[model samples]
Target chain A: MIKKGDTIPGIFSVLFGVLILAYIKTNEKMVVMSADTYGGIGPGFFPFVCAVALVICGVLLVLRGIKQNGNVDYFQLTPERKENLKSVVMLAALVFIMLLAWKVSKMFFLCLPIYVFAVNKLLKRSWLFTILFTVGMTLFIYLLFRVGFHIRFRP
Target chain B: MSFELLMSAFLDLLTPSVFLYMSIGIILGTAIGALPGLSATMGVALVTPITFWLDKVDGFAMLMGLWNSAVFAGGITAILINTPGTPASITQAWDGYPMYKRGEGGLALGINVIFSFVGGMISILLLILLAQPIADFTIKFGPAEYALVALFGMTMMIAVSNGKVVKGLMLGFLGLGLSTVGLDPVTGLKRFTFGNMGLQSGIAFIPVMIGLLGLGEVFYQMYDYNKKRAAEELEARKINQSLGRVIPTGKEMKKWMPRNIIVGLAATVIGAIPAAGGDISAIICWGNSKRFSKDGENYGHGSAEGLSVSSTANNGVIGGAMCTMLTLGIPGDAVTAVLLGSLMMYGMTPGHTMFTEQLDFTAQIMVLMVLANILFLIIGLATAKISAKLLNMSQPTVWAAVGVLCIVGSYCISNSYMDVIIMFIMGILGFFLKIYDFPSGPLVLGLLLGGMIEKNVRTALIISQGDWGYFVQRPISLVLLILIGASFLFPVVQGILKKKKAPAAE
Candidate 1:
């Protein structure tokens, strides 16, 4: 029977499998045979097998999805769902900004408090509490990793 | 086994400085285990550098205490939150969290500590008494056998799928595929790196695990949060401010002790197998105990015995892992692998000679393990109630804290920002997987075991000149193959029998 919410994941799986298979075909380094070692099967054999199996499973999932009678819009969201999505997006955005800052400026310590304060604020903490918590958290990380553990954070 | 050596080792460990170091390790390890992204392995690794500055007895004792205590304390967080503190404590979340939800948090923590103590002591005893035999047995495992061991681990995917077999298999294969992204172990050729330098080393395990189990839980809480539910939780916490009996009744212990002992023994065996670690042991022991336990129906829902089995299995591996390291000069798991380096740094080589030539040192290690277990048991029991206070914190506080911890922990693994990116992606994937009713355990297991399986399988095939029949020819491989078959089939058979009995009863 066709199942609701199965179509997208199934399609994603199929596309993923196809992408791997296509990569193997185009990459000259993806060798299927080599006389170098004892195992006759080369590096490509295992991935090839995995990709084929994945594709088969994806096809089965797609078939099952199609056979289902009921379907709903995947993007439809209730108020609660919308709220939940907002929280997830907010948290993810803060994390992304922290990483992006590290990648660009190599000043992870500078972005640490910003990320922490933003998250605390997102969680609806009082402004004073968020500011203090952010400072305390940043200090804790610095002391724990940089000072105690002797971790060098140079890029 | 010499009384004089044992006495000497015990006396050495009794020294104030050594004991103080071990106590510090216990407290430090508890904190490490309670933190979502910090694991026993990482803790041990981080402390290894510090150990270099200390005397051998003091250093080894600290490591022993930290390792055992860390494994024991993972159950604390698993009970408090629905996330495992370490991968080894994953099964603990299945039952311990549910038990906490049902207000048996105190008892769950008690069982977690008690059984962890029992398991650790039994494993050390086995290490002391049967190290040679166990090592001898495991050392015979060739490439085919190792491959089969990995396969055997994967069979648990079915049991862990939460009855969604297709989704589980799909995720499991996806993990396997993802694992193949790095350089090909056999040929040194990259498969799926897409020319990215970071992709050259496969997806990092800890980051993905932290994302899936730790951050994913946070997202799930956010997704399911509602004001009414939050209010209800707050009310419940207020009413349950005091932790009820932290000790199990005598009868409860009597019933679960035997099962815990069996799981401990099984975990010891699994741990002695190279490449298998506490996570594998815990999963196998927890799954098997559920299948055979009379309280099987209540396993994932909040069975005390299930939590005990998981807690015990994870720590029980310590001694077994040491057995292999001491007797065969082979690292049984990653922690032992680090210990192996430490052992060599002390001008000691592991092998059969270690039992005789380094008899005093060996006895010291065994004694250290016992003392570590006892130390943590006392600390864990005394603090069980206090640790449960974590549940009283506001949900948002935990959410923000865990989110930041996840990022910091992932970044610390190798000081790589790429790991953070990987964790973020996996966190989103994990959230989606949960929404779609997909089980994440199988995926984790697959990724954990994929490299081992592929490397061993290829090595075995090459050794056999591509004759697959060579796998069945070895006794160990043959037995493992049978076990693998049985692991997959037993559930089906059990289901069929249950159906038959249901009809008859009707």
Candidate 2:
């Protein structure tokens, strides 16, 4: 009774599992050492098992999804689906910017207020409260960590 | 526990900073609970990271306080405006709203606050008394037994998955696979560091947790913006919030005391069971109490007895949930799942070690839970009228603040930008998981237990020279294995029965 969407996550799982298995095979550290010894399960053994399980489940899921897909149209882009996609896309952009600010410039503090306030702005909060919240929160977090807790932030 | 240690734990809560944080948590919990869309889980999840910088004891005190008060706050709207602020408070609407319609809203609300306090108190007492014995029992467990214990936990994900057992298994296994990304626990060999220095220590689970529960929820919340808009409009209209009488008379309290005791005990037992959330505890308790009530037919119609049972049982869940989380290393419910993560962050594994070594801290948690209920009553009643103003803050504003906190909190842990990147990626992954209707509880539980399971399996294998029979040779391990098989089998059998039922219904 697996639906069509069930296969989508399963496909990703299959791809991920394959990549891990490939890496396990190629990696030097994962090799079984002292095979003559009793109970000498190597580091890769557990992950190897996990990968096999993943692949098996993935294949089962994909087959189930395919069989189920025949009974019902599974690719319909309902409004809820569109909204879900849009939410992820917008969040991704915000995250990418936040990451770049952290990595490229290390301006976590500067990016902090803008990133937070901008999301609020997008959500249609009053400009003044959003700004106040941004500034107040930035200072509070800064002092709470850097001053109160002695944890330093990135420059 | 020694009287001195118990007293010391009480004294620990008296510190100005700890008291302040507890007050803040109660205030926040009340606000979150009073708002229809906001929930205690979201309040706890959002506020969890802020406690990262606080001392461990302070952090738990704040969290426990928040947990208690947020739950109590949900009934406020039910009595005042015929709406339950949290799902657990839906029972409040049945009796409380009816009373409000009859101008006995004050009496109903007062009953709610008093009974909730009693329920929370009883639960903490049970948690305090039972946690040590449970830990003592689990202390004798071996690696093979632990492996079975973890397998048993994974099976529980099916029970708790809210009918999406397949998706639960898929994500739970995914979490286990992801947990193996660092050095192998058995061989000390790197498995999936992927050449990144940060990956050697393993994916910081705290960041992954924040990503999934915190930022992940924000993304999902934003997904159905249109629905949220309509909900917000409805919220704006339901602003007839005012507290009339916030405390119950002694005679009224005495009247419900006997029934409250019965409901409270039942609630704790039910809460100890995985997948039985606060809502279920309230429902079951209320349903059971119907036979004992004099006005049984008026059970849902302004019956103070109805308010008493529901309020008591929901809070009673807190103690049972904590006991399981602390003593068994298994989360009692979703919030305790996060609480389990918090225990990990504080370097305290939720098992026998807590009793043998961190017994004082364990005792402190028990005492603090009791105190949280007391303070929640005090602060909640004091601000009962004003706490409703919490919804005055717009939804978008709250979401925006949560978004910022998620990013910042991810970065604050270990001060690693790489963790931030990891968190962001996981946040996106978590969003999809949510959109597709997968449970986050199992994934988090799986991640917590994955390493334990792997280490135990390997150790057990090494001890018995890779004999598959080793897992069942010991009595404890045999019992655990049987339990594991039963757990996995139960769902499949239940599914078959359900299929048969569906066909007959058609």
Candidate 3:
């Protein structure tokens, strides 16, 4: 079982590197001149420095991981553990269905039943309770965001 | 600080809309916290869109409620299934799961809930009373001071990583670098977008959070799911029957009351500091409880004190984090980062002027925190047993639902399909990172702090006429710098001293 303690920093380093490279590429003009005095360096200067520092840190991390025998093994998914994959999928489906219902038909209330049914079927929960929970949640969202705040359902 | 202003602020917060928003927060917090792999940060991020249309007070109130309740409720899943709902609750599962196996799950959860409530409420009270003074003190800090504060926050990762100073610093700098993505805040130039449109805005914080915390867990779970189970595993894993009564005995409560209060207070104070959060508080408290307890050996075997200490410390941080955000305009955690964004969306920028100018808004959020705590206690107790049944569900069904939620959450953020793609990519990256030994907290922290660090550095330097001396000249900045320096060196020095003392003691 991969623990949280095992995996966060590596992904962060790569992502940080990607971000730095991206920033440097996008704002080319900002890098060239110290036009404004946000500091002794131009506005781009701090971010550029921060980015370089981040890359150095990332390189060190990858090296450390290699030294510790860390690699793709941390990312491997075993078959038995795949049973729990349904949780993430179910949550994603719920959101997709809700958004689809609301977006296509503007029938925000329709999403409530789907939510209830999904929760019920997935948890093997009591139908009565699931229904109540679904309805309660739907109504709460409606009343709070739609009715009270007067937000329009995205069309 | 005027009486009239305070009265009006109180009135603004007491309105029915604020209560309604707070209620929504509590309910959402409980649901998200009760689920395994779902974290409070993700919950807040997903819910932020709902608040986009709300009034400033109502939106802030809701986020606050969610923040407090989510941290407390995370223990529910940990106690029941040995799976922590949030990173902060991971330590709780150490003792909590053992207690569950010993058939004291209900009692453990009950104790955890009560202590969490007490811890959260006390912290809120502290925030309400001390916010102005703290803000006033913190406001004295300038750019150099903020940089120092950021440095101090980064250095604390040493304590967090458990003596792994090199790894912690590596991770912290990595986070700081990731934050540098997107167009420079002051100069409008991009640093590292790599010709990708999505990269133009830099890396989105929500995607990183969802990927690292949420998807990363999924990958780990998949690995565990592949492991073959012993025949007895099914029987051993069956949940224990409820103990009927929810509350602990009066004697038991009385014995732990003083300790609980002390733990709660200490946790709150620590939590108020930026980058330090519930996870750190809970672990620190749990460690301290073991160190001090006469029955320390029983800690992982169903000790009520252990549960109380961990839960209290975790929940206590919510209010403390809020104090930093409302008073000093610095969000202490991811949830508050979303809240800060919401505040910006509502055209309400939090600062010294916010207290004097937007007193009502500030008061409303404070009141909502108190109300949310009460609601969380009531709802949490009532739903404890029932919520645990989620663990029994078939795997496929649950995955389908979560998949839907991820899609919806991503799409809702900007009403853009591109964001969904970004979310998916992040999720994959997060999964891979989890397989490798890396910390995601610093990455998230970097993403959250990156823009602010850039914007502030520029503003501060401009004001100082491009003089570096200005940063050192300010009293507040000088103090913060010293503190940052101390934080960085403390662990290294301590480790060396320990190494030297070890041979002498031997």
Candidate 4:
């Protein structure tokens, strides 16, 4: 009955803290204290303290995660929750595709409207309304960013 | 406080362009605040990046107008529907919806608009009177005291986290740790930059803010929308939309005015506390007013006085929050955290300098705050009837629009694609944080104040020749540490007392 929600962040923090500790150890320049330093404390001191605190807190979270019997089991995906997950994945994919398209073409004006159109379609809007919305939103963004701010999308 | 400077500020804000921006912000705030899923903090976060392109006065006028009106407009949905438009309006729903059920929708709406304005103006007057004294006192603070102030601000994470103190502290520490990704403050040595040019300057605050507040909320709403739709609870409710009289009689107003003034003053005090914003203030005020009122029996059923107190308290926090942020460089809540970041973007630092070097700008802001409340009062009253139409906006449309804005807004900050990617990553992380019931406010406060806390602490260390005793040796720092300890311990003691009282009550 352990909550995956609590456990995952706990483990993540512990690993993250360990990673920081490992990275700082490999770099001699990132010392917590140096004899020649003005304050006798080096750049790594604050982050080092944070890392240790993170590890300690992470351990506490893991213990709490194991002890608490939460209502929702993160590992078990209900049908509606699955649909919710899919919608988010689709949304993230849409944005990623827009970014990739903009990178390849550098034509934000063209890419933006198409991105909007795709998003509206994903949201299950009528085709006609989606087209109109895409056009209206694109023009609004264009007029605001391009005409008003005079920001050039392309070099 | 001089006449010339005051007149200059008035002249600056009296321009048509400034008024226009303020009007647009008011309009947007009304729509945003009347919608169930959207929040004032999210609206402010979304608009903040766009404001960077405008003049300081125009930009702040828009922000001030948006913030004040959004808090006020939340009552629109609270009265019309049982659901609150924003967290601040939660208490508004108690008496407001029931009053609407009794066909007093217009009266409830009227009370909300009038009392919110009154509360907002009262808080503004307090801000004007008190901010200078606080700033002058804090001007003499040493680095240790300043560091303690930042630490004290971070402890607000516990308050905002809504009983998840450990998780809040963890995320706060995560923010503080992430803040050290760039150059070391004391030494010029770089810490976590894997040699990327972007990492040299560190993670940008705006993009992360936009991601967490904007995209994060959208994603969660999408998920929640799906759940609601699945449950078939999306069916439109049939309620009386007919609004009766729009204004209360003078006799009625006189009856409620004293109680409302007391509640507004109390809310102002609560709002000045770090992390205690409109939502918390309103709840405290509403509960306390009910406990003391002669008509306490009618509180939840349908008391106009209760609605007035709730409405007054929520907007009353604005002036108090601004006072803290402007004078102490501490954000009372998420919106002010974003505002603090925006101020930094404008090449202005808050705190003592805001009164000295930036006094003109500060005066302009004060004038704008007063102007914003007046503007919203006129507009909110005029548009109260039409506000119900705002709730009809499609959830999908809002989600898509907010999502695009989040992506584009982050990119608009220096036209960096890297920022967009960072925003996306943070969006996913923020979604998870929300799913797990973690409060994003503390995370944001930590991110915004992390550098201040670290920089001040290190500087104090240097001043004390690396002696840790410096913090305790200073009177102000010692006092702040005691306050911090009390802040953490109070909740624990309260929880223990509640546990002890529960069994006895049962």
- Candidate 3 CAPRI grade: acceptable
Q: Top model by DockQ, which number?
A: 4
**Each candidate's root-mean-square deviation in Å?**
6.5, 3.1, 5.8, 1.9
Candidate closest to the true structure, highest lDDT: 4
Better of 1 and 2 by lDDT: 1
lDDT of 2 by residue, B100-194 (tens): 76667667767777788989999888887787788889978988887877777777766656667766776777778788877778667776776
Which structure is stronger by TM-score: 2 or 4?
A: 4
- Given candidate 4, what's the lDDT at residue A153? 66
Clashes of each: 3, 0, 60, 0
lDDT of 3 by residue, A45-69 (tens): 6556665665666666556655655
Per-residue lDDT over B112-207 for candidate 1, one digit per residue giving the tens place of the 0 to 100 score: 899999999989988988975654566677889877776765665545444556676777688777878898997788778778888898887767
Ranking by TM-score: 4, 2, 3, 1
- DockQ (CA atoms), all models: 0.56, 0.50, 0.30, 0.61
Clashing pairs in 1: A2-A67, A2-A68, A39-B462
In candidate 3 the C-alpha lDDT for residue A27 amounts to 52
**How well is each residue in B364-443 modelled by candidate 4, as lDDT tens digits?**
99999999999999998887777776777778889989998898788777777878888988898898888777777767
Error of 1 at B163 (Å): 3.1
Off by over 4 Å in 2: A1-3, A31-40, A70-88, B77-86, B227-238, B241-243, B249-251, B291-296, B299-302
Which residue runs does candidate 4 get wrong by more than 4 Å? A1-5, A69-76, B2-4, B227-240
**lDDT for B26 (candidate 2):** 86
Model 1 lDDT at residue A26? 89
